[model samples]
Target: MSDDRFEVVIVGAGPAGAAAALALAREGVEVLVLERGDFPGAKNLFGGILYTSVVNELIPEFWENAPIERHIVNRRWLTLDEDTQIGLDLKSAKFDVPPFNNTFTALRSKWDRWFAEQAEEAGAMVICETNVEELIVEGGTVKGVRTGRDDGDVEADVVILAEGANAMLAERAGFRPQMGPRNRVNAVKEVIALPPEIIEDRFHLEGRQGMALEYFGGAVKGTVGSGFIYTNHDSLSVGVGCLIEEYLRLNMAPYDMLDEFKAHPMIAPLLRGGETVEYATKMIPEDSYDSLSDLYEDGLLLIGDCAGLVNPSIHHEGTNLAMASGVAAAEAVLSARKSNDFSKARLAEYRERLEDSWVMKDLKRYRDTVHFLLENREMVNEYPDLAIRLIRRYFTLDDTPKDDVIKELWKTIRSEVNFLKAARQMWRARKTML
Candidate 1:
């Protein structure tokens, strides 16, 4: 075995690790990325949507060369109440043109491997099938990592921990918190294959154009969770997720929740002929500013999910944050290398870079969002039901008088969440919404 040491060691070859590796390697620095999966994205899943602007900033006009499935021309946010759905849909023809504005949905199984290859091409040595077990520290500073692979103690000037939700290695170095039930969401997503034409027609998309729909309310049964459907080339990515703590309290099994979500009349008709292709469940980190541990400790910095960079309410909005954090980490590493200061104080600049980006600003904005949902679960579950019942009544076209319908609306609202609780919830939601 050869004694090969890199300037930086990154664990987990996901979007964050790959982005950091590509950025650093392009600067002519030795970067090593280690992954436990046989290949990148092998164990990853999401209702995967990749916003191209971020990717283009890392690799210009990346869509032209990237293995993307389709352009997203339509997006819908659906708030559901059993069989009823109220949604906001957005579509633009310009979104399909050069340098697409919105993102496209893709299967991570294919996209992640290709993304990692870009880092490899840029000269970052990515080693997959290697499990990083612990961080190597010396004189109160991280120096490298110890992997589970035989004869796998690799040394580096700095180690960036990008290992997803199980950010144990980073926590060992005191870079993050111990995983708490409320701070994470257990998500299960499945890919269901429909014919390409059917998908296009169902989602109302043009040639290779796709749509994304986010579900609320009944999906997670009032928890601060969601169900989603995103269009791929010939398939629909569908799933539901909720806080692990809430699931425990509600005694909700994820699969049971998924079953209820898919059976909704609105979703069922759309996925009529599709066949389930893949089944996967993983924990998603929901905490942000409060969840972030020591991002920079001595000669190491943590990026991506390891830094607890996810916004819970939005549903797996971590990839963009991860890439941004990785970019910041890479820039900081390059600066430290040039100045020859691998000290903890020198690497703290990475924190400033993150604070200036949306990664930190947005997280700070929703810092109290998770607990808000925990406190007021009825807004998501019961309110939607009340709203739907009112809509159904207003549009029933019965023999009842028109004025009576208006009176019914008030009666239903009072019956279902009660005015006082609704007012308190509206106030709480508004606090962190803006």
Candidate 2:
């Protein structure tokens, strides 16, 4: 074999690539990982929730040594109007225990670099600051990858692409179609720094326990998106994201939307005196299960965001699914190596494994959610405002009698809502969202 050749060459060192490398290295496979960033996670961004069930399967009790910010004990779902907020709040002592409901918050820059180090410790060679330009194809099969550096062609029996949402390499290689604006979401986040005590007091957290709050409706100015605030140890990860198509329709910028979200009367008090420590923006692949790209080709596989593995439902799960796909890819590669066949047929096992796991099942179940929400813009734009007004009227002290108050509320509902249309929308939500 040439000096640059390996048993497997994996691109990008995010959760998916790192998990693949770790699993392969543990089995004594000669694997090389190429990372474009100065290090893994340097350019990665997410909404700050890390569902750790997949991580536990990869490295048992990972939170003990991982760079985790906090274990979430409180989860709140809020809907906002211009001046009012109302929703459900659930806080449980059950989530404060070990395993912590498999939920935690982490900064990707710290988490990704640390995860790649685990692969390195397991004997995988991870090279950073090297950009993979394209796949080296021969006779209709992938042979390796061509990097930007001189003599940068690296050979492998098989290659895995964990490149993120932009997926230039996947597009160039004809592995997938170009993602449309409807299939993409542009997210912006800022890590706001504050004293640990202040953070705990503000968010009602104790010790390493944390809170995750999700905002909808007027949070994004009634756009088809959501806002989030996750409590880290001494910082808050505050962000908002929406469909790129919505941004174009509204003729608005993401940063400007973020500023408006921060200035909201209901949102400002929580972040009254914080310093911005880090800000980032990235595009997330939100393709539905029906539109997901093909997972494998001749001697090649795609995982993570490159495969459009994000579950864009209310759960907002991506990292866990990405890591799960990585492990499946590694298992498929190991099985293929035993037979010394790295053909497209052999890599079919990767897709089969994903289909058998929760990764694909959850995605398939929520296949219609994004489209359903998009079609019913009133769900975000009008419903929340209507709900808040009704709740506020119910709570306000007035001179009207109880019977009169009930009559007034019914009148308002009748005037503002079409009962038949609402019933149909609610029934559709039961199938698509619930």
Candidate 3:
């Protein structure tokens, strides 16, 4: 064996890659993690919401020393209709207790680097600023990767691809195909600085406590997109994500939609007097299980955004899936190393593990759901409008028969959205979600 080569080589030192590297290193395996950015997460962005379960699996009680913005205590989901908002609120005083199992806001630029350091400390060698160009192949059996340097053809028994959204290497190797318009979304985000006290007052929270507000409807220029505003210690992460198909049809720059969302009457006040500190944009794969491409080959495993693992239907839960897949890949590699077998048949265990776990099971459950929602265009536009109109009518003070109110509701719903269509959507949602 060459002195420089290792048993496993992981590309992209973000959550999945770092998690995989750390886990493999902890198991006493030789792992190498490579990052293209100047550092592990210099090119990464943050919505700042991270689940503790994912991190705790690798580093139990991670918040003990990690740079966490705040342990979240409040959550609000909002549907906006012009100037009005319909809200669902959930808050628990118990969340402030130990183990804080939910989540906290974070900056990836700092967190990813820290995670990479953890991997390094666990005995994985992480080299930064080295971009892997393509996978080195031999007679259709996966072997290793070729980077962009003179001695760049680094060989390994196994290669784990955790490259974020582009996944160019994965597409090139035919492990997965390129995403269609429906499978992709363009997300634009900004980190704006505000006083910590102002953030507390505007979001109606006590000292040092943070709140998350997700906005729909009025912010997207009536498009099939939503706005998100999540609080940090003294900064707010605000952004919008729209399907690539919708973005092209509207011929609008993402930044324009970002501006519209900020200027929204409901949003503008919270953001008032705040200064935009940084801006970033990235592609997120939101096509659910139907978009599941190849996950395994002879000597390679794909994890994280490279495999298109974003569940936008929920809280954009890709990182957790990434970590889980990383763990599965590491386990498969460890088993194969034990048996000295790197055949495709042996590597199929990773896929089986994925299916048996929540990552693949939940994704496959919602595989057709994205298409279901996209097919029903009115749900994003007309349906929400109908709901707001019904609420407005119920509160109107004009003298009218009480039974007439029911008739008015029916008339409005039928005129704005066909009853048959609405009923079909409800049925489809129930089936698809289940």
Candidate 4:
């Protein structure tokens, strides 16, 4: 209730932090969100599309007010070679219409600012341009946060860490391990401006409907990473990302890989003459289930990417998990407040809540996926070329027998990768991903 104290303090104003601030403030809890950026979203970026169900639970029909570009109606998965690509494009009319769909493309800088405003409207005090220097702890319990400004020690009954993927303050407070030591993927994205009509025509869309495309194989220059392209209202988000180890091994810059991806035969045509207006680089935590940081301690909790809550499955769903964990953290904080107990044992309920929510369940289900896929990098590099070769042969309309073509395709696949190794990897994928 005072300038120097609040019932709950959240660091970082990304999705998770904002979600927590909104939920707590709506319930009349004194919550303070500290954002290091000049504004809430000045430093935030995402591939594109926000899974809005969790957020909608907080703000019903949020799309009507949020700065959304388009609602996704099509999903494309492409396997590419140097000069060729094979893809599956799925589109549905069901996604074009109230409750249109759960996903929408948004510019984070715009979306996050609006989201923080929502929190502010609900009575949360959000202070931007303030970097938390350290957590004030007493007797191993978090008491408040220390910032750079004079007399900047602000007190709080509980501190929630939603400070994005880098989690510097959490690491400094010894709440989690250094993010640099964990498995991280470096990604770079650029927003290319295009005409709205051109975007709709090129992607086969109509009236605010959008498409999301993901690329494998040559996208990462055959490294253990992937690339993505998403259609905004009048722009395209194109980026490439790879594991830190792969980046070092390949000696490739994330932006350089993105440039190469943009120029690919199958990709270049899509962005023929678009002008790029925005660029961002981010670090995604690929070690979701295995290397999750400590989630809670006395009077403190961690949520979102700070806790390594990313789902490293094929979907790469991070924002949904972030919002879900934020809600769970807020609920736990409310419970602790009701009991007037902010000890470690009381805060442990946050983990229990996540375990019961889809955030932990989904992460647990695909826990082995990242490791499995990383170990099988050949699937990203060799198999796409093999697939292209087989597809080319299959539809060549030659005078050869269909059975003979099948035999040749099988032979070609075996020659590129050891049959046993491929089979083993396939089996592991089935066991882990399917």
Report the C-alpha lDDT of model 3 over 1-434, residue by residue, as the tens digit: 23357789999999889988988999999998889999998998746687767788788888889877777789887777767777689898877765664577888898889988999999999988889998888987767888776688778899999998888999987888777787888889999999998888888877657777777665675566678898888999999988888888889999998998898788899899999999999888876676577688888898989987766674667777888888888888889899988888888888888889988877877787668767876666766666777887887778888689979998877777666878999888777744
**Predicted structure 2: lDDT:** 0.92
Deviating ranges (above 4 Å) for candidate 2: 1-3
List of clashing residue pairs for candidate 3: none
Question: Which scores higher on lDDT, 1 or 2?
Answer: 2
| TM-score versus the correct structure, for each prediction | 0.96, 0.98, 0.95, 0.96
Which candidate number maximizes TM-score? Answer: 2
lDDT of 3: 0.82
Q: For residue 234, give model 3's deviation from the true position in Å.
A: 1.2
lDDT of 2 by residue, 264-358 (tens): 99989999799999999989888889987678999999999998999988899999999999999999999999999999999999999999999
Worst 10 residues of 1 by lDDT: 311-320
**What residue pairs are clashing in model 2?**
none
Give residue 28's error in model 3 in angstroms: 1.1
Off by over 4 Å in 3: 1-3, 396-407
Which lDDT tens digits does candidate 4 get at residues 181-297? 237888899999999999999999999999999998876787777899999998999898788888887777777898899999899999988999988899987765756765999
Comparing 1 and 3 by TM-score, which wins?
1
RMSD of each: 1.6, 1.2, 1.9, 1.6
* Rank order (by TM-score, best first): 2, 4, 1, 3
